[model samples]
Every structure is written in structure tokens, then in C-alpha cells.
Target chain A: MLINVPETVVADALRGMAAAHPELTVDVENRVIIRRDAPVPGKVALVSGGGSGHEPLHGGFVGPGMLAAACPGEVFTSPVPDQMVRAAAAVDSGAGVLFVVKNYTGDVLNFDMAAELAEDEGIQVAKVLVEDDVAVTDSLYTAGRRGTGGTLFVEKIAGAAAEEGQPLERVEAIARQVAGASRSFGVALGACTTPAKGSPTFDLPAGELELGVGIHGEPGRERRPMMTSGEIAEAAVDAVLTDLEPRNPVLVLVNGMGATPLLELYGFNGEVQRVLAERGVAVARVLVGNYVTSLDMAGASVTLCQVDEELLRLWDAPVRTPALRWGM
Target chain B: MLINVPETVVADALRGMAAAHPELTVDVENRVIIRRDAPVPGKVALVSGGGSGHEPLHGGFVGPGMLAAACPGEVFTSPVPDQMVRAAAAVDSGAGVLFVVKNYTGDVLNFDMAAELAEDEGIQVAKVLVEDDVAVTDSLYTAGRRGTGGTLFVEKIAGAAAEEGQPLERVEAIARQVAGASRSFGVALGACTTPAKGSPTFDLPAGELELGVGIHGEPGRERRPMMTSGEIAEAAVDAVLTDLEPRNPVLVLVNGMGATPLLELYGFNGEVQRVLAERGVAVARVLVGNYVTSLDMAGASVTLCQVDEELLRLWDAPVRTPALRWGM
Candidate 1:
């Protein structure tokens, strides 16, 4: 459904998130940070957020091990500067705060503005913009690339790095390195309904699926006839592999776009493993399921991250987010 | 798409699962137990299983705080007697093992046969059949109500009781308490496509949704006109409330039927909360997301557990399953 009530969407979503996760405390009045606990004194806090629909994204990912704060926006829309400023202030420790943002025009602009505002408050602030989606490379009238699935990996790896007492610059550099090594490509079998409008964002026929569809249900570069599970897996993995060139061992994520089945995801992951093995790429780690979703759209995305020894070790570090937690 | 390959479906799926969760081993050749660590030497082990399509249900739920073994069946079809026999043997400690069987006829019969077989080996065995779905009251035609979402809660709570060094009878009692106090009702917005069939299990209209649908995409108690989020929530919650008089604070689960969004689930949870409040029912805990699902059918289920102080404590205990983990 096309939900048009953009003004209250972010606030309402945040309220819902806070209610769902009692561990998270949201400053609903000011659209500030939602944290599991107050930032540790003298610790360089980490704050992140972007669009709303890709939930459990910045919000569910917020906790002790990951984000100190998350600022949510409307569905597929960027959060404004005020929300980011509030989030930054709420999470700023004496050591400083770092902003981890996706590479979107509105997100970059608003986060940049928030960083400046925080600087005015005598808080040291640094920003790292994630541009990892390989779907779009170059274009006028648009950002260079859209940040998609890789944001999760970067947030997690960087969050671990920060938790280990890394400085803001070092954390930002590690996050950028993680982002640079990751690439994702997705396909949509159907369009999602924006909650307010109560209608689908786009029309897709029963037998047709879009290749390389954006998370916002935006048109992909190609619309092809429906293919078998293996064919679709081949297409998606090929796109991600060609873009990322994972000649070494890599962490693979076969993520569902909201409405796909875990069965299908596993099936797709099997195909991905086969294809990667055939191409002589070792699968070091694999995560298959709904990590980052685009509402209830029937689709899936493949993400590949080439990992050196250090990257793999960082990936193995304990993470304790509500969505992804292991080891510790 | 429907995929028919009855003979290989379960094994293939298990292979994929083992690959995805390297921490858990899948005995594809023998349908045995999966343990993160070696089974306790003298403890009464617990093993469970049924149909395979319920990803993360009995399988994803196997870990530290849950099952010692899970026997998977073909897609939506129950496993054969031999599979259960092997499962029972694999996890049998010197003390014995408990079989947590769902209420389906195939599951009960096969598990019963397995129990008999295990008895032949002089192995102590106990079985607790779970029938917590409130959709059906009569067990004449279908061996009673089909076990649904309540199985997870029962298993977790019972597993906790077992982990606490409770005897077989005590663990069984706790499992029965969970089953007796819990009730679930599901609605399917669309039919699930069996991988083998490549077509939906059943047809659904564009705007209509089926209420009380089964996990295997079985026809629900009713297929009604599509309504607002509030209306659907009211209907689901009403069904659960009517089935059980939950006086104490209750744990409510708003579960997606594979294809629904967390946004809609949260919206439904809000409506459910409002309805329960109108009825003076207090919600002690709430979990919203795709916990148990039927492939990619767009729908949801609501589960209510009447919790007392003990059950609440059990619910609060740490669980380390792949799907539901908290506290720890």
C-alpha cells in the first residue's frame, strides 16, 4: 500500500520499535537516539540511522554491542537534520561520537548538518558514508551508489571495532574498509505496499520478477521473465560476485526481501554455494534469512564480502544486537 | 514455485540447514540429533520433530536451551517411523529421553512407533504430545487440534525445566502446563507454494485472507473478506482470548505467516493490545515477527500464554536458539 502520511511515520515507527524492544529507549519527542543503555562515559559513541522500512536495521541493531543511537526516517525516506542532531547529542560521550550513514543524498546532507551542529556543541564528530550497493555505479541526478545490505555488515564489524576502544578515525576507516569490500544485488518478485497508501508501490505480474530492484521497490535495471530458483540465484550471485570479485574466501549473505520464505532462501543459498564453489571462491561464512528487509516484498538479495584474515576475525567478534547475536 | 521431489526434499533441506548453521550438525543419513556440545552423559535428553517446511520451528530451535535432536520430514509431510526411531536413539542418555510430539496424526503415530522401538532397546522414553492450537476443539478427524505456535513456547519452557535437572515427569508436567495454557490462531493472506508443486497449496483471492490457517497451509477454519489491520487483529485476538481465560498477565506473540512485514505485525500488535486492554487483559510480554511461518504465505498468527510467576520466570530465562534468544 502507498502510505502517504509521511510526517508521522517516523515517530509512529519509533514508538512501535521502543514498545517492541523494551531494551531500547527512544526519545520520541525529539526523534533522538534509541539506545539499550546510556553511552559509557569517556567512550567514543557510535550513532547511525537512515530510512525506516529497513527496520531492525538501525533500530533493532542498536544496543550495547552495536549502535549507541539510531535515528529513523519515514518509509524509504531519509531522516531530517533535527533528528540526527538530537541522536548525536543523546549519544555524544566525552571521547566523541561517530556517525555511520548510508550513502544517500538526503542522509549524507542531513547527517553532515547534524555533525556540524554537534561540532558547535564542542563534541568531536566524524562521519563515514557507506556506498556499497553495486547495482548503480555512475549517474547524474542521483547519488553514485545506494547503500544496501552491506550497511549491516559494516555496522556490525565497525561496532565491534569501536567496542574494542578504537578511536573515531580508526573506527571510521575500518567501517569504510568493510563497506568497500562488500557488494549486494537484489531482485523483487512483487512490490511492497507503503503502509499509509494501502496499495502496492509498483505493479508486478504473477509470473514476472524484477532483477536488481532497489530496496524502496524502485525499478531495477532489468525486468525479465520469471526464472527458476537456480536461475534467479545464478543471476543474483553473478551480479554480486562480478561486482565484488571475491577471489578469496568471503562471507555470504542470502537475505530475503521481506516476503520470501526461509525455505526458498536456503534453496537459493545452496545454489549460491554451488556457483561460488564452481567459480573457485571459498565461502568462509554464510548468513541466510531476513537480516535486512524491504517490508513485505517477495524478493531476495545476495551479498558477498571478500574478507582478509583481519576482516574475518572482526566478523567473528562477538555481536549482541537483537537481530544478530553470537559468541558472547 | 512448487518443487516436487518428495524423496530428496527433506534431506536436501537438511543439508542446506547444516551448511547454514555450521554449529549444528545434520545427520542426513540417519535423521539424528544436533548438538552444539556433546550430550550430557546422564541427563534425560529431549528430541522432537515433525514435517520439514516449518523452518526454524523444530530445527532452527535446536541449540543450547532447546532440543537435543530434531527429525525432519519431507516438505509439509511427516517423517517416517524410522526417522523418529533414529532421532530417539541419537539423543538417549543413560537416564532416558523425552519425545515432544506435535498433535498431527502422522507425528503422533510415527513418534509413538519410535518410542516403542526405543523401548525395545531397553531405553527409557517419555512422550509429551502438544495440542495447543485453539482453532479446532475436536480431535476426531485430525487427531485433535494441530500443534501450532504454542509448540515453541512449550518446548522452550519445558527445555528450561529439563535443563534445571527436573525429572522426566516434572518436565512433562511443565510441557503440559504450557500446552494447556497456550492458545494460537493464524490467518493466511495467500496460499503457500510447495516447492515440489510449484503452485500454491490453495488459491486465495486478491483481497481475501484465510483465518485459522494451518502451518502446512491447511485450509483455515474460515476464509473471510479482507479487513483493516485492527479488524484482523481483533478477530485473531478474540479467538485466542475466547479459547483461554487468561486472568494473569499473558505473553502475546504476533507471528507473521512467513510473508508479512514487521510493520504490519507491529500494527496488528497495537490493535491486539488495544483489544486486550478493552477486555482488561494485561500483557506481560509481547513478541512480534515471523517466528513460525508457512512458506511465503502473507498472513499472521497470535499466540497467548497465560503465565503465572513460574512460567514468567521460565520465559525470562536465557534461551540460545537460532531463532529466539534472550536474557543471555
Candidate 2:
């Protein structure tokens, strides 16, 4: 691991974030990162968080047109309810707050508790759970489908709605709509080693791959020998399209799982586009890079969200975050 | 290799770029990506290219405020002169063009030949060579320092100048100034495997790392047992600051070499900032992410460029590229 102390990984990263981006107020003590201009008077605030490994998803997405506050927990562990409640209190204005929770056992439980706590404090709170992973009905840490790459789409689109001064109810509806309309599938070429472990999380032989791996290295559908990018794309896209049965143009996300370079991800995306075209599916937009990730895991994930004109417009809106920024 | 065929890796990635970014006209056959709104009246055009592996370097950087055109060669090889000449002709308005060439011998030679060819065709051309890697005086691919992470800084600030309608001479001078004022040092935790070779580029045993490594796995100053991020930051910052005794504030770029995760990179950045503070160097701005890369090598490089007020203004200028986008 390229870290000084495994236990201090999240805190150290927060300090670095504070230094690199003075636009955000990083509370290392509480493990929350909030936009400096948070608590916009008449705007609904968006909050999302989970374990620490999947970066740029929650913390890096905190800015003007995205998350207002992100609570990062220890690596692969769910954040406590206190972090979420504190983030809500810090960012919530009179307009209320929305919590975007990924559907993991611990995260869902913790966020549910935080929502109750926030409401007790007289802050109106709404919740949207993202469970767009189509790989399994249940996983190691999830009762239902695991939330994977589709969380990015939900955050981005819903964030735009919030930034435009939509009420908390409308923003929650948009977030839920995005989560329900999206599907994701991941394949792991190799395992990731957590800082505390100092070794591979799972045994993934060099010549084999996990076809539908979970983000936390959970067991997937099956193991297979190495496949070409085209083959992998065909399987992944088919997995997503079959389940989604989208009637509208889809936004495509070709995401890297930490260690996969853009070179390979872009090549894979080309194949993915070919497969989608063959299926006569129109792609509204395509994003190719790492957004959601496992720590140094060699793999890639494909996420597709069926978007309406309104959702597409929101996706195109200006955002000014650290990891994802444009149109500012 | 996450590609259909090793020989067509670059082509496949280009096709994907064309699909992803409609604002950039990707010429797969010509191996160049140009802004769709090229030949912007009196604006000086910025052109850059190199081997395809260091992605998002030249190609992902083509947009409104960055390079006007980018030519991509096969992995680990310099682009030919024809591509550069073609790009020059396509984007050269009456205001002329500037070529940002890295210091690899093949790149320098090919760009030189292309500059002469473009001049013969009645196109005004200026050149700035980036040789900012302070690891070794000479290495496997160059006679002087190797061009690495500092290329991002040069492209950004110089591209800002070009976008502001600076003459070709001024843009070239700014680029040269940035290249001269910058220093970079890299550390590799592991070796990268190229698509063509389909094997590790070099041997890096477990529990070991290479300090002062080049972007392409070139031999570094020494190999030692793996060090903590703080220790590594101390050595890297020392290497850069010792050679660049700047009297002005510096912009810091903590760049990932493909396989390193943001989690580790941010933790490492924290350590880097501590060292810079201890050394009493004020940082005007900092960028953290993968801008330049070597396939999927697990490592990072730190780049520091001294900045004056004008240079800082240019650096803060809006850039709307696929990779680096802000202030737009």
C-alpha cells in the first residue's frame, strides 16, 4: 500500500483534499467533506457517502452541481450514523436535505438511522437508495442488488436538479428515477489489496476473471478464463441491456476499477458501443474513465441509464467538483 | 491487455474517443483528434502528440482552451511526422501554430521533421521541447531529462495563453518558460505490461519499488524495499526541490502513473504537502489525478512549477478538455 499508516488512510486523504481544494471544507475529525458554499438558502442539499475505497463517487463529487456533503468511512466499512447526521446538519438549509444511500447492508442501516436522527433535529430529510447492480439479487454485504457504478449517474443528475433549486421531494424523485432506470455489471481481472490487509482481498488467479464481481470483491456469478475486450464488452452490455430493456436513449458509463488504464477502458468502450449499436439502442452520451473504483483492482464496469430529455439536460448542466467538473 | 487485438489497440481507443466526445473530431485513420471548431480565426493553435499509452495527455486534452489537435502513435512509439503535418494543416489559421513536444528522442526527432515540413508548406510553426523529468541526466530514451508529468503543466498554462489569442511566439515562450521552471520526480511500485509485449515491461519483485523511475519503466536511480508514502514523498520532493530552488510560489501536480488509486494518491499527496510546507515552499495551486500515465504502472510522480502572477493567471484560465476541465 502507498500509505504511511493503514489506520489513518481516510483521515490523511481528507487532509490532502483540504489542501488541494480550498473550495471544500474537509473535516478530518469527522470524516466529512462539505462544499464551502454549502447550505444554499433556498436549495435542496444532496448528500451521498459510503466506504472510502470508491472515490470520486461521493467525496470528489461534492461541489456546486453535485453532492453537498460526503461522509467517508474507513475502507470497506460503512460510515457511522453520526457522520451522516452531522453532514446533514451542516449542509441542510430551510429547503431540507436528501440522502443518497447505496444499498449495502451497513450503509442502508446507518443511513436509515441518520435520516431518523436528522428529522428529530427538525431537518426534513428524504432518502433515495441506489441498488442498480444487476449482477445478483443479494451479496455479501447487501440484501438486494448492490449499488455500483450507477450511483454516479444518480448523483450527477439529481445534483443538477438540486442546484436548480428544486425542492427536496423533486430531487429525491429524480434520484430514485435514475437509480431505478440504471443497470451495472462489473468484471474483475485481478483483486485489490486494502491498505490494512497488505495483500490481495481475494484469490484471483492471473489467467481467470470474475464475470460479475461486486465492488467489494464479493463472489460473482462465475469465473472464466481471460477474454478479449470485445468478448467482455459483449457479455457486459448484454447483461445490462437484457435486464434494463430500455425504451429510451441510454447514457453509457465505461468505468475503470482502479488499476485499469484509460487505454484499455476506451478500447473496451468502443466494443461496448458496437454491441449497443448492433442492438439498435441509441446512446445519448458516453463517459469513459474511473469514477467508482476498488482500491487498485484491475477491472472495469459498464453502467447504462435510460434517460429522458429532462434527465439528459440535467446531466449536461454545469458542475464544479474536484474529480468531475465541467461547464462552470 | 484489455483490447481485441494488440496491434489495433490505439485504433480501437481512437474509435471510442470519437464515440465519447462529439465536440472533438477524431480521425482514426489519420491518428489525430482535433477540436470540431478548429481554425478559430486569429487564435494560435496548440498541437501535441506522443506514444498512445500516456493517454489523456494529448488526446483527452483537445478542447476549447487546450490543444487544438493531438496525434496519437502506437503504444511506446513516437508519432510519425506526417500526422503532425496533417494536424498542422487542419488547424492552422492565419495566426500560426505551436508544437508541444516531449523530450523522448523519437518524439523530438519526429516533431522537428514535422515542423520543417509544415514550414515548407507556408504554415508558421513554433516549437517548445519539454524535458522536465529531473530523475536522470540521461536515460534509455533521452539524452537529457525525460519529459513526464510536467507536460501537463506546460500544456495547461501554455494552452491558456494560446486560447487567449496570444501570438505563436508568445505561446511558445510561455511553454518553454513553464518547461524550464518545472521539475518532476517519479516512483514506481510495480512494472507495467504493454499490449504489444503482453507481459510485464520489466521485473519488479514483491515488497520492492523503484525510485526516480521514468514514465516508461526506464531504469531509475535505485531499487529499495518498499517505503511508506511519507518516506517516498520526502525523497521525491527532495529530488525536485534540490534541482529547482524557486524563489516564487509553485504549482504542484501529484500525478498517478495509471494503476495507482485515488485513495493512495491522496494519502501520498498529504505527505507531499507536509514536505513542501516543511521546506517553506508556498503552493499557488495543486492538481491531483492521472494526467500522464504508463499503461497500468502502479506509481506516481510529483511535479512542481514555479509561477509568477501572469503565469498564475494563465494557469487559472478556463480549460474544457475531456480530462482537465475547470473555470469554464
Candidate 3:
């Protein structure tokens, strides 16, 4: 509703980011946002990117303790290999770079090619794929499970590790560990329209919701009659708990998909807490709001990551990003 | 979409707030969210609130450098005088308490009553009215201009002043100054549905937009055919710039009304920046996101706060709220 035109949406948004945040170096022509303090000597640099609509995901996350750089593609489309390669080269110190790629076909293929190109340029590159959405094993844009809210977890924890001067191998391992320990489940109350499409991506009936919905409006497990927040929380928590089976305290993210207000998200988080308590799941920390999103879809997703002491400490470390910031 | 029922929505969200922010004491029964470190000795306490649907306005702003306490009412309803009185008593140290009231009739009346009641209890009280909306001189809920995005500026700058151990008189003066120096204008592409109504609050035809929309679906200046983001920005910035006509650098807030995505907000912000630059308004800071909001309304508001050195310093102070946090 607030765009000048479909064709210039990404560029316009990039210009806004550049203007809003002078702390970061935004390359509008190349579609990359990099922390001005990039190429920190002997620090592992974390780089991530994907489609543009899921804000505060990659671009807004570029700061002191998060991604060193991010490549933003058009809405619901993966960034090309050039953007990733340029980002890696721009931010890579002699210590190397870690690519935090979400699990989508186009993203995975492009990041793989970018990794090879960066390696050819004598810059060490490592990749960790986040496929934590437990909704479906495969989806329209993904060969395996899709990446959803857990991308925030992976980037944050691993970014802290990198900021602490962890070697590339250790940083990559931490990112992969976070991605492995997290699982996500989503529900869509209404479909979101892409700028290019200019219409709802999928038809959602008035009185029903999509259970286990994908972030990009992909089909979920099934469509069901609207459920109470408690019922939805029970279903969502059960889905993640069954797959994750956390043996330690967990970090929880009650994420809104673009259009859901914080009022609804907080209410949903209360119900989520109730369900987790009933199941005896110890929660180490809880974050509620729209961090990862699906454009303007009216929905929410829950991501759970089992956290040990080390992971918890890293999670609590200082982060200064546009979307997520705490501590110092 | 995530509520258990219309009646339990506010209470349920309070429970969620309790779960999410243990640093804030959430009194579910009293509908007051207070910072755990309230009533700091020799420091003036800042208190504010209004309707509940504006999630982060008062509730999410409760922390060290923003609001000491926030009294949340039902959706689009004024918080009762009792809530404000209790909040004042609970948070008032030896220094006193300041109430930041929006200019809505209900809010003004209730806060006035609250101030008297608190003063009767041996607690000193001060009040500042925020009437920054430039849409109209009067509205359905307000006699003067309706308060909008500028409430954030008042709460933030004044909160910072109070945090600096300012006296009640000085803090009140700062808040009133901020409220007076700010101007706001909003545009809504769609209306928001209340939980109780279970439907759109007002009918906004698909191709039309409401210029200068109020926070609670109140009638605006006029309705017009849908305009591009640039056109909307021009109109919104002009409305504010004409009224403000600032001679100094400004702090800009491109706030989303509930359901607008960050993508659109950023794109709109770019146009806002262009317009401001062309108008010779030197922007010292730009914050783009949903700060003040209606419930699930697809819209955006522009707020301009003329800031001098002191006000800008207060604006840049450390704020550790759930919604707005920076510096340390």
C-alpha cells in the first residue's frame, strides 16, 4: 500500500535504509547492506541474505554483533550470486566469512556458487543452511524443510561467536548448531500479496486458517476452521516439541508474519507459555514480536531453540542491530 | 487473529507481557505495566497510557529510559482514573510523578482526575498534554488536535530527562516543550477491525485512502483515490512541514499504523527523506517502524520533532524498552 511502484520497491527501500542508518554502508546499486565496521581484523564475518520482504531478517540485522553484510533480493526472490560474492569480499577479513543461507532452492544454489567464487578469490568461505521449519519436509521453493524464524536465532548466536573472535570453523559450527537445534511452525490467518503480484498470493477463506503455513505463502499441512489462540498455541507447540524434544531450557520466539499486531502476538505468546508450562518445557528466554516476517501476511510463527549455558550466554551477549538490540 | 476471545484480549496480552518481559511488572488485574525499578529515589517518574490496541505506545515503552509505568485500557478506550492514580502512587518517589496524557477528551479528563487523586495522597503530580496531530483542530475523541506519533517523542525525551534526575517542574516543562514542538500527519489505506466489533472499524473502499487518519478510525481531513508512496509522502510531509515550519534540525519518525509491513514503511521513508531534504529540513535522526499504531490498520504516519542540542541529547539517551532500545 505504501510503494511508489512495483518495479522500484526494492531500490526505494534500500535508499530508505541507507538514509535511516548511516552506521551501515548500503550499496543500492548492488543490493547489499554492510556494517561500516566490516572487515574487522581477525574476526570471523557473518553474511546472510534472502528475499527482501522478511525485514529485520538480514538487512536490518547488519550491525556490530550480527551479520557483517546482507544481500537483499526482490520480494520473495533469492538474491543472485553476485550480491553474495560482493558481500563476502567486502566484509571478509583475513579471518574468513560465514554464509548464513536459508533453505530455499534459489538461495541454496546461489550461495553455493558464491561460496565457490569467493574461494577462487582466495577468501575463505563457509556456509550453514537453516532449514528449521518443521511444518513440512519439503515445499514449493525448498527441497527440504524451509527456513523460517530460526534464521534469527542462527544469525544472532553465531554472530556473537564471531564477534568474540571465534575462528571461521568454530563460528560456522555454532551457526550450524543453532540451526540444528531450532524448529519452527507457522499459521497464516490471511495470505499476503507480493508487490510484483499485486494480489493475494493464495486464497484464504474468511473463517479459516492455514496450519503449518510456509513463510512465502506456500501451502501448509492443512486448512482448518479458525481456532482460539489457546488451541492454536497448543497445536503449534505440540508440533515443535514433538520434533525438537528439548532436553534443556529453550529460547522461544513468538514471531508475527508482517501484518499481525503486537497485541495479538503477545496474547498468542501467553497461550504459548501456558502450553509450554503444561508440557514441562523450561524456557530460558522469550522474545515476542515481528522479527522474521512474510511480507504482509496476517499470521505468526513460533521458533524454539534448545539452549545450553554457552548458547544462552552468547544469546545474551550485546547486539546492536536495527531490529534486535540489547545488553550494551 | 490470535485472541482467545474478545473479552479476554487485554488480560491475555498482559499475561503475555508478563511472560515476555520479566523486567517489567505486569499487573494483569490492574492493567498497569510498570518497570521493576520504579520509584527511584529523587527521580521524577514518567507515566502514560491510553487505549490498548496501540501495543507498543505505552505498554511496550515501559522501561528505564521511556515510561516508568503505563496504564492500558481496553481497545480504543481511555484508561480509567483509578489506573492512573494507582500507577502514580506506585511509581512516585520523593521527587514526584508526571503524567503524559494524550489530548483525547477521555484521556484528559481521566488524567486530570488522577492527578488530583494522587496529589491528595501526598504525592506531587504534574501533567503534560500532547496534541501534536495536525490533521484537525477537533476530532470525534478530542477537542483540540488529537495526539498521534508525537507521544513517543514526548515520552522518550521527557523520560530521558526524568532519568537524569530532573525535578518535576523541569521534566514537565521538557515534556510540554516536546509535545509543542512536534507535529504529525497520518494516511490510512485501510481500516482496522476491533476484536469486539469482529469487522472493519470503518469502510474504506479498496481504491480510496484516508488522509490524516486518527489512531482509532476517526475521520480524517479527507478521503481520496489511492496515491503512490511519493505522493502520499509529499502530502503528509507538507501537512507537517507547513504546521511545524521548523528552523532547526528535526527528528523524524515514519511510524506504521499496526499492519503495514516494514518494507512499505522504509520505501515511504525514502520519499519522506527526499521531501524533507527538498524542503530544507535537516534531519538529525530518522526512525522508521511501527511506534504508535491502531489495531491492524494498514497505514503510516509522519512525525516531525524539532530538536535542539538538549532535546537531541535526550532523544539519543539510552532507552531499554521492548520496542525502542538503543545506546546502552
Candidate 4:
């Protein structure tokens, strides 16, 4: 059943989340962050955001050890410059604030504009744009490749770097390195329903799946006949591995596209582990289930990160967001 | 794609859960719980259990402000006396242990047997049997009306009472009061696939929904033609409100049956709030989302509790479990 949702009501969902989780606060009027307690004067703050619908992403990732602020846009659309500007101002400490953005054209332009706005206010600002999705063929133009699953890994590792008191430049550099070292590929078993349209964002036959699909319900490189779980895992992981051929140990993520069950995710992860073992890939870390979702789409994505010693250390650090809390 | 799952793997799933959440230690060999520190010295411990397949119910609810141990059974099946006895021994402090049990025939019998075993060990024990589901008509003989959503509220309130260093008798009394004041009813939009069976646990046509469905995939009170979201919410909330007649301030939980999205749950909550407001029922707290799920069944349940001042305070207390954490 399709329900027509208003474009602006996307913020209502974010407000609902903020109301439910008091540990996090939102600027409903200005799209800023108030730190639940607001105005932490001494800490080096970090702010990040992009499109909405990849929930528990930037919003759920906001807390002590991760992002200090997240500016959200409409569904699958980049936040406007005003939102990022407010978010930057709200989380800026004397040390400086860093913005982690996905390398999409709209997001890059808006965040760049916001960075300028923050700089004009004498707030030291740095930006690290993630462009880790390997599915896009041409990197020279058209947003120069899109950011996808690797954004979370970058967020966690970079958040840890910042939490450890790294300088903004070093943290931004580390975030960029993580993004450069990661690759991802996804397959959509069914198209997602846009809240505004209530119908599917795209259409696929009952027996077919879209391979290498984008997170925004964007069309993939190809659509293929439905295959076994093992086959799907092979295609996704193989594509990622081919792009980032790292012999070093890696972190593997078998992420759900929102609507898939954890049970099925486990099955998909089992297939991933089996294939990686066959390829003699050394897996240093593994995370399964919904980390970044595309809003009720029946699909899964595989992410591989070529981890160095530094990356591994950052990955192991404590994180205390509403969604991904570990260690402390 | 019906996949046949082995029934024996249900226990394995529980073991996996214990492994996943280090906060709750599990005894795979004995199916028990000792603290991560292995046995708190002198506090009176609490243990609870019932059927499995209700992810994060008995298992997820086991934590600091909740049960000290939970004995999970086969999929939708009751745990044997041996499992419950082991759980009892592992959690038994010198002060004694309280068993918070739902009042199903199998659950009562098994817990009773376990209590007797504890008595033989010279370990003091008490039991609070919960029968809060209001859907069943014959509560006198027919399995005492089948415990449902109220199990969560009972556990939370009773857990708080126990945390306050109350004696076993008082804790049991509080639990019983919570059970008496709460009522719930649910509608299943679709059947869940049992992991072992690989197929759905029940059959429902595309347009039909089963009302008053049990947490363990038991047949609901009735199956009627599927209706709109407003209609379903009306039926579920009406059943609960009629049973409890909660004229006082209440906590309303619109819990997903497992697979329903937050989008639909929010719509359902809207209907629930609208109906309760029209009926002059004041809602003190509202919790919507998948709290107690039946694997991947697509449906939701409405639970309303008539809270006294004490109960309301307890409900507002801090909890730090993996599933439900707030005010902490």
C-alpha cells in the first residue's frame, strides 16, 4: 500500500527520534545540534550529515564519542546549506569542528557553502568528503563517484581519532584515508517505497534483482535474474574486492537495506564469510545487520575496508552513540 | 522459498544472543545466568522465561533493571524443567531468587518444577505468575488466558522493585499488580517464517489479518478480513481498553509483532492516540516500535496499563538493556 507523505514531514521523523532519545537533541527550527546539554566549550567537536532516510546513520551516530551534530535533508536529498551552517555553529568548539560529508554533487556543494559560512564566523572548519562506492564507472565527472556504505566506517574511525584528541587536520586526513581504502556493492531484491510517493521508487520483476544498486533507490549497473544467497554474496563481495584488492586484514560489513531481517542477514553474512575464506581474505572485524538503511527496501550490501594498523586501532576504540555503543 | 530449520537450533539462537550481549552472561552447558562477574554476592536474584521466538523479550529484558536470568525454550515451545532448574541455581543468591513467570500451563508447570528443585537445594524461592492477556475468554481453565504484552511492563516494574532491595514477597506482589493492571491485544498482518520450517508458521491471505494473535504464533482469537490501518488500530486498542477500562493515566505501547516498519507503527500510534483522546483516556507515556516481536511476523500489538503513582515512577526509572534503554 502506498501512502503519500509530505516532503517536509521528513523532519517530523527526525523530531520523533530526538524526542525518543533525550541523550541527543536537535534544532528543529535551525537544524542544529544542542548537545542535549549544549555548548561544550572545551571539547573538539565534530559535525556530519547528508541526506535523510539513512537513519541511525548521522542522527543515531550522534553522541559522546562520535558526531556532535548531524544535519539532515529530505529523503535521499542533500541537506541545504542553511542546515549545515546551523549544525556547524552549534557544534563548533574553540579547537575547531570537522564536517564529514558524502561525495555527492548536491551534498558537496551544500557542505562547501556551509563550511564557508562557518569560516566567515571565525570558526575553524575542515571537510572530508567520502567517495567510496566503487560501482560508479566514471569518477572524473558526475559527482566523481558516490559515497555509500563506507561512510559509517569513516565516521566511527574518524570519530575515534577525534575523541583521542587528534588535530582536525589529522582526523580529516584519517577519515579520507578510510574512505579511500573502502569499497561497497549492493543488490536490491525489491525497490524501496518513497514516503512521499507511497509506491516503489523503482520497479523490478518478481523474479529479478538489481545488482550494484545505490543507496538512494538509484539504478544499479545491472539487473540480474534472482539467484541463490551464495551467488548474490559472491557478486557483491567480488565486485568490492576487485575494486580494492587489499591483502591486509579487513573489516567486513553485511548491511541490510532496511527491510531485510537479521536472520536473513546472518545467512548472508555466512555466505560472505565462506566466500572470503575461499579467497584467503583475512577478516579483522565483522559487523552485520542494519547500520545504514535505505528505508524499507528488501536488499543487502557488502562493504570491505583494507585495514592498516592505525585503522584497526581506530576501529577498536569505544563508541557510545544511540545506535552503535561499544566498550564504554 | 520455504527453508526447513531444525527445531534444536532454537537453543543455539539463545546462546548466540548471550554471546552477542556480554552484559548478559549465558550458560550454554547448563542454560543459566551468572553475572558477567559470575554471581553477585548477596542480592536476591530474579529469573524469568517462557517460549522462545520472542526476540528481546525474555532474553533482551534480562539485565540490571530486569531479570537476572532467562531460560529460553524451543521455538514457541516451553522450556523443559531441567533448563529452568539450571537457570534457578545459577542465579540463586543467598537471599533467594524470584521467578517471574507468565501463566501458561506449560510455563507454570515448568517453573513450578524448577521452584521445587530450588527448595530441595535449600535455596529460598518465590514465583509470580502473570496472566495479563485479555483476549482469551476462558481464563478460569483455558491456560489462564495466555500471557502477552503485559509481560514486559510486569518485568520492568518488578525489576525496579527488586532493584530497590525489596524482599521477594513484595517484589512478587508488585509484579502481580502490574499484571492485573495491564491488558493487550494484537493483529497479525502476516505469518512469520520459523527458522527451522523455512516457511510461514501460519497461513493468511494477502488481504487478511489475524486479530488477537499470540506471541508464540498461536492462533489468535479470531481472523477477520483485513482492514485499513485506522480500523486495525481501533480493533486492537478497543480490545485492550475494554478489558482494562484504563480511566486513569496510562502508558500506551504500540509494539510491532517483529517485521512491521517504524512508518506503519507510527501510523498505528497516531490512530491509538486519537482514539484514546476521544475516549477520555489520558496517555502518560507512549512507546512505539518493535519491543516484543514474534520472529518476523508482520503485525502489531497495543498494550495499555493503568498506572498508579508508584508504578508510573517505576516506569520512568532508568533501564540499560541492549533493547530498551532510557533515562540512564
What does chain B score (TM) in every candidate?
A: 0.94, 0.99, 0.99, 0.92
Error of 4 at A98 (Å): 2.7
Per-residue lDDT, model 2, residue A76, is: 91
The C-alpha stretches of model 3 lying farther than 4 A from their native spots are none
lDDT of 2 by residue, B166-218 (tens): 98889999999999999999999989999888888999998999999998999
State which candidate has the highest lDDT. 3
Candidate 3, residues A1-328, lDDT tens digits: the string is: 7899999999999999999999999999999999998889999999999998999788999998889999999999999999999999999998999999999999999999999999999999999999999999889999999999999999999999999999999999999899999999999999998988888999998779999999999999989999999999999999999898999999999999988889999999999999999999999999999889988899899999999899999999999989999987
Q: lDDT tens string, model 1, B213-253?
A: 88877776788877766677788888888889987998888
- Ranked by lDDT, the better of candidates 1 and 4 is 1
Residue A8 in model 4: lDDT: 43
| Residues A47-118 of candidate 1: C-alpha lDDT, one tens digit per residue | 888877786677778876678888877777788888877777777777788888887778888889988998
Off by over 4 Å in 2: none
**Each model's DockQ score:** 0.40, 0.81, 0.85, 0.19
Rank by TM-score, descending? 3, 2, 1, 4
Model number with the top DockQ: 3
Candidates arranged by lDDT, highest first: 3, 2, 1, 4
Give per-residue CA lDDT, model 3, range B187-256, as digits (tens). 9998998999988999999879999999998999999999999999999999998899899999999999
Instruction: Decide which is better by TM-score, 1 or 3.
Output: 3
Instruction: Provide chain B's TM-score, model 2.
Output: 0.99
TM-score per candidate, chains pooled:
0.93, 0.99, 0.99, 0.81
